[model samples]
Target: MAADPAIRAIAALDDELRRGMYEFIRDARRPVTRDEAAAAVGISRKLAAFHLDKLVAAGVLHATFQRATGLRRVGRAPKVYEPTGGDIRVSLPPRQYDLLAGILLDAVLAAGADEGARDAAVRTARERGHEIGADHRRRTRPGRLGAERALTIATGLLESHGFAPARDSPRCVRLRNCPFHPLAERAPDTVCAINHAFLDGLLDGLDARSVTARLAPQAGECCVRLTATT
Candidate 1:
């Protein structure tokens, strides 16, 4: 059987030396070379290189070749290690605490000046959805979008974002699942408001004059529904 990618990635850091090296590289403002990693972990350069390569293979770190100094040198540029943007977590039945933490952090930051966190989240979510819609328009070049075409584009966007949209009728699309899920259950008002605003902004950005986003929350379904206007 194939090893789970997340498990393999996490197992790479099981070793004390590799874990220490990973922490050092992650905490550093800049990438670290094999030599620096070796010095930090009190290991030989060859051993450090082996462990670092393993980390790279497991997707725990990213490797880039760059000259240490600004000036180009005769020898090959040193290999540097940095933490990968991706994260690895192993959980049975899948819980996403990180996602919750991120949302909470955003809300806290937005509340710094006594502003409403839900309002801030809704604004941010809408802006992001608008950006996605604008990008989709630019890529597909769907000129002078009509109601049908706009619904098609919106459905495609929703599917890409894991919304599982189903066309209930010519005038309505029902989402089969809530991408935000349990978190939405935990904070219905905040999550649903943000979700509604996001879809609203998306339709606006797509210039879908004939369709509107409405909050029609139902059990086991998404909080927002896309409805075609007359």
Candidate 2:
């Protein structure tokens, strides 16, 4: 099978020079010539051309030919590069965090009483989380699951969802990655509340009465942690 185009595009940026050129091109706000890209990154024009072609092949950029602006003499329009502006995301186990963001975005646009958009987003997140929880329970048909059993099950689900949950002890589980990153970093109060509510609803649906989701924000990790109420 062929590699995913978006992933390939992102992977192409692993090189420091290519990544720098990508940034310069993206920020230039217009098509950039190989000379300009090379100068910006302090690389040879020949080398820049090679990397730029790689970017174009990976679909991270588009190449166009245009005459130099304010120049009367033109032998040929020089090939210039520009960003494709496509949303590209890659996760190790793959996560649909954007799906959650989109759901919350729809709720916000519906413009319920929460003009601030926080309440509406939080409510939607809780409902969505509950729906997921209920669906998982229905699929598995788990019976009389306790906190330990429920935690084990929830960790598996959370890991696939990109929460990166780690069981620190029998009573506590800490999340190592926030799937709703960048956004969570930008707006912690609203986003973190949504996370807490979502996890709480998940536990409710799972009937995990002894495990509780708590807000214990830490640097470089998820805002919410699960603790055994018992």
| TM-score on alpha carbons, each prediction | 0.59, 0.59
lDDT of each: 0.83, 0.86
| lDDT string, candidate 2, 36-95, tens digits | 999999999999999999999999999999877798865888999999989888875445
Please report how far candidate 2 places residue 183 from its true position, in Å. 1.6
Best by lDDT: 2
Model 2 misplaced regions, further than 4 Å = 1-88, 92-97, 109-111, 114-116
Per-prediction backbone clash count: 0, 0
Task: Output the TM-score of candidate 2.
Answer: 0.59
Candidate 1, 74-164: lDDT as tens digits: 7888899999977787764344455335545666666547567776777767766777788888888888877788898899888756688
Report the Cα RMSD per candidate. 5.9, 8.4
